[model samples]
Target: MDVSARWDNACRASLFGSFSLSGPDGAHIPISSNKARALLAMLCVAPQEAMERDHVSKLLWPGRFQAQARASLRQCLLILDRALEPQNITMLEPSHTMLAIEPSIVRSDFEELIEALNDLRIQEACSLLATIGNKPLLDQMDFGDQFRAWLKIQRKHVEGQLQIAVSRALVALDRDGDMDGHAQLSEAWLACGRADARHWDGKIRIAVLPFEQRDAVGGPFFLAEGVVEELVSRLSGVSALAVVARASVASVANSGRTIPALASALNVSHLVEGSVDRFPDSIRITLRLLDGPTGVQIWSHRYDGTLEGAMKSRPHIGANIIAGLCKAIGVEAHTRAARTMTASREAYSLYLQGRALTYRAIGDGVLDKAIELLEQALELDPDFAECWTALAEAHVNTIVFTPQLDRVERSQRMADCAARAIELDSRQGHAHSMRGIHEWTLGNPLGALDHAYEAYRLEPNNADVTARLGSFLLYIGHTQAALPYVEEAIEQDPVYGRNFAMLCAAHFNLENYDAALAAGQRMIDLGMPGMWLAVIEAALGDNEKAVETYFRQRLLMNSVILPPAGLAPMDDDARDAYWTIASRGICSGMEDDRAIYCQILDGLHLAMPDPCDASIALPAIWMGHAELVMKLYRKQIHPANMLGLMSLWTDVDPIRQTRLHPSFLSFADDIGLVAAWEKYGWPDLFPRSSHID
Candidate 1:
């Protein structure tokens, strides 16, 4: 440990102070020289993963001689070691390639500064007196161009880190169920951005229409208002649905249009309209789904439950109505949806009221209320597949951040309930979705993919189905493959919350930074709070005035990373294929990540034998190392340790690729790719661009 410290510490004499080896207790060591200190700081802050020598070379001496720079660095290291001895630290060691910091117990001012700065950002009250009192590094001496660049980089990074911390803190206040804190933080971020901050902020949209009357007699507006309020609470489950408040919607309740026209007047895709007919025996309510664009009836249904327990039951019924509407638009019903609907209806109504209190708590606890409702619903009808599904969904909902439940428990319960649902109705895409989640949790990638695909197969037009599949694809790191599905999901049901985010995230896997930005903006426009929104916004250089709402995330009690982590590389079939498509799409415009699209298929030179989606695939019998590009061609995967996984792509069977990409000429004479292209339908497909490669 002693020797490691000596080798690792980049201690040197500071121009502002005499040699020392002491912390506040005077054991801190100093850097050997200004240059050495800068070099050390530069290396320490470099992205932690592997880095090439060329990067350092480019940063230090863009137009200078390498030998001179190396000599300067070596001299600084020697002096720095001597300066570090008092603090029992070493700054560097001889390695196979280049100098590296040795494992050591050396204290570093840079590290301390970073920690201090980050802490300060979180709490403005954090004392900077110690930092202010500290002696400056080489304060009087000129550090030169290389050192200057390093300093600039450090300052940029430090400020960025601080901003993120502050923003995150403000956002947290909003998330831990604090509306006032949330509003304050959101306003703060927004104000800062609007004033001088580089980042842009998020926007909000809302729609409110007349409540379906339970009794045309117009008893207490509370019941009618409450029912509408309850429906908004249910729909808000979409997460992205900014269901306008009853007060706001009341202004337009008398639009006099049908559901479709009413929705149009409200400027929303969904319009909820109904009339409560009273009879001697029970209450009859008629509801309708209207296409806001054309003012046409998309779908309509009627319910005949009595008013004996209508207040509490209305919200759940409303949830069922919304879910039914989403399903009609082709959204897959998953376990999550079931949980939201089946939780305690009365409690859920309270929860809806709770949402109105965005003035008060977050909507998260709605799950607990939902669980209660579902439990009660089950008590009333144990064999009800809907009830079972909702219970499973409630359990799964808890899995997102529960300390008690493991992922396996969530996956298993969801699967079991879904299986039960399917036992009752195999055509239920939502049930299969649960089963797929189980397969994914169990490390069966193919099974997961198959289940997601099956859900789609069962309901080709379902938005939720496509959204769920896209989510599954993205989670597996096959982001490129998720794009089409996500887009279709959003298209099928534009109101499906988070669908746009999913679509935007798909671009991250392909490293399509620009497209990712556009996607983030779309979400902000629709109202979503996520890392991707900030990231893509950053990637696109749009630090205008959006994304301040993300500050609402910073106000909670938790310690969260801001801007979050960057996306990892695409290491699977799904990922590679998506990227291949994205890259080709960038220079070209391949719409599909499927193998049938020769653009992406052209990058693959491999195959899969037991292909889940593709009929013809490569065999293990004649396996070969897959090239990066080729791997992208196949949408397949191999799970890692039941948690991590390599993404999948389309199959790479020789026979399949022949049909998918076609490496041979039709006449069997020409061996060139152009001849193969000629045989394939590239000219017919992408008529705007011919194959240049």
Candidate 2:
């Protein structure tokens, strides 16, 4: 074949991640040695695809004698050429004075990226950039200092050019009034920026308002909710856009505020609003993309389709909305790959409705209804991974909030649902996260760790994944390692109550009592349950605040009994049982009552093995049930336990004298707790003398 034809049908080299050449059929052509691979990469990234022999030798062998360097270079080239020869393509052209790749014989993705940018083929350039995808150039290879320096400069130059091309493309699309094209480009541009270490905080933030329902007669009112949910889920996957949470949008959705006012309230730069009209055979959706600050409609579209057709077209409609918004702001928006699928529209809609209901139906009949809806969804489409994952999550919530249920059976059901989700789609991060929680509840810490790590890897920016991983680490007694992940989760999702709760637990474990108390208070302020706050207050010796917090929680539970329609479900029996136990402990100083209360609460909350004994021990200590606390401590320190370490805190000082017990001392010795105390001193919140006391 001629050179150009050969280039088209010959092996191509990938310089990103690991250096490797792939033949025409996409099989790897292994180079003989690291030096040979390095030499090839050096040539490919070199200016004009050519380098003088003397310069190449000096760069690859900076410390060697000139003759020795040149000899090494020649040997490396021979190895590389031999490796390329089997592919029937000329990769390198060598001469007495210089070496170069034949102009039309080989093509590099890096080179094509530059060519695409030069031609203003931004979309093609962006696609190629995704292939490189933040990987360091010739990532695994270690070369001489001179060549490394050249590689660094070249990588930076490539990144800069990619960023400029993306910026130019976005501007051009906006100027041409091609909103859909601009939206499609935004994701790729953001990916490039992220890979190049550019900040994306300057990108426009958009919120999708809950679509209003008009003239609906006995159809699913939740169809609007399902559509809005799908749009939000899809848009949130776009790294270039910051999507406001559905809860935030729903809070002011019907306030009759102007677009500018609503946008300011939600802290968003743009808004997407739509109205859904349902008829006998079809659903019509009219959507408008609005400028948040100016209340201007940038783009509007009307879509008419059957329910099934609308379900299938939601992604395309969402993309169009994003495109219009991005174009309005002189940027690009790229639709992310869809991660959810369902063969039945009814199943898909039911899943969305189930998720919505589940979020609102904690601990009550509504949760059961949500579960029923999800079960119906599964019956309609057994392969619906999202429904399975959602069902697993709903079961987990039941395990946490509905103590009246058969805890063991519920836990097993959760595990089964999560496993089914994984079987259907192992790549779904939600499945892995749910499975991790299931494993954690089963007291399989190592299995939990594996699933949690995989979930985090698949969805690094997902706040829920971050929280789960951090919580898993904390539960396993890796308090220090878990702190940053929890903190980052909080940063990413400041409004999330669970993140703050995890932070509180982490800080308390670290013996940063003041910080822990502050986090606990923040959780309470956010209208989340704060049973832990009372414990923290009691531990800090604020008995009055602890007593007040106890009553406040009771009052909160009372109010929840009459919760607004469709909100969190109320389990009166479970609430009453909890109250009866907790009230006895608080109402009197009787040690037996306190101990009973602690044990019952442990049975309720410690549905799984608690390696650190925090579930039983912390509450016992808070209630001043010193004897029961010591018993729980002994159980935690047993030799058969998987975790050799015990989490100690300053709050346990009232039982300091118990350290002299044979079991306590032996446990300390077995876990090196005493040695840790002697070497590193007591944790920041504890008194040094308390360890020996």
Instruction: Pick the TM-score winner.
Output: 2
For candidate 1, the lDDT comes to 0.44
Off by over 4 Å in 2: 1-206, 215-217, 244-271, 288-301, 329-331, 510-515, 558-618, 621-693
Q: TM-scores of the models, in the given order?
A: 0.38, 0.56
RMSD of each: 21.1, 21.8
Backbone clashes, candidate 2: 7
lDDT of 2 at 592: 71
The TM-score of candidate 1 is 0.38
In candidate 1, what are the lDDT values of residues 1-693, reduced to their tens digit?
121234243432222222233432344455556556655545544323223444455345444577775665567667866765655545455443465554243334433433333232322212221332333432433344334434443444333333433443443344455666455545544443322242112111224355555454543222344455545545544533334334325534664545534443333444556566655567676666554434456577777866655644654676677778555433333322422232344433333332233221124455556556556555654556645654665565444322221445556776887888777756677567667767754545456667888988875544546667877665444555667777656544443336656665566446555455555555654434444454333333333212332333233212221111122333445444543332222222122422233423232323322222111112110011133223322333212111111112222222123323333222112212233234332322134364444
Worst 10 residues of 1 by lDDT: 613-622
Model 2 residue 9 CA deviation (Å) reads: 75
Report how far off residue 341 is in candidate 1 (Å). Answer: 14
lDDT of 2 by residue, 1-693 (tens): 122343567566677678787888778888878877877777776434467898778667766888999999889988887888887777788899988876455567766665564444656766776787777778866554346545654565455444544554565576777787677677765664443333134444577887888755675656777767767776667666656655446556777878866865555656888888888778888878876645778788787888777667766766776676566656556756766678687787788788887766454477788899999999999998878988987887665554332544676787789889888887677678777765544545466678888998877656667777887666444677778888767644545666777788777777777667667766775677676676666656665556556656756753332322223444867666666567556433446766688667566434433423333444554455444545554444321112212223333543333343445545444434445445434444435565433
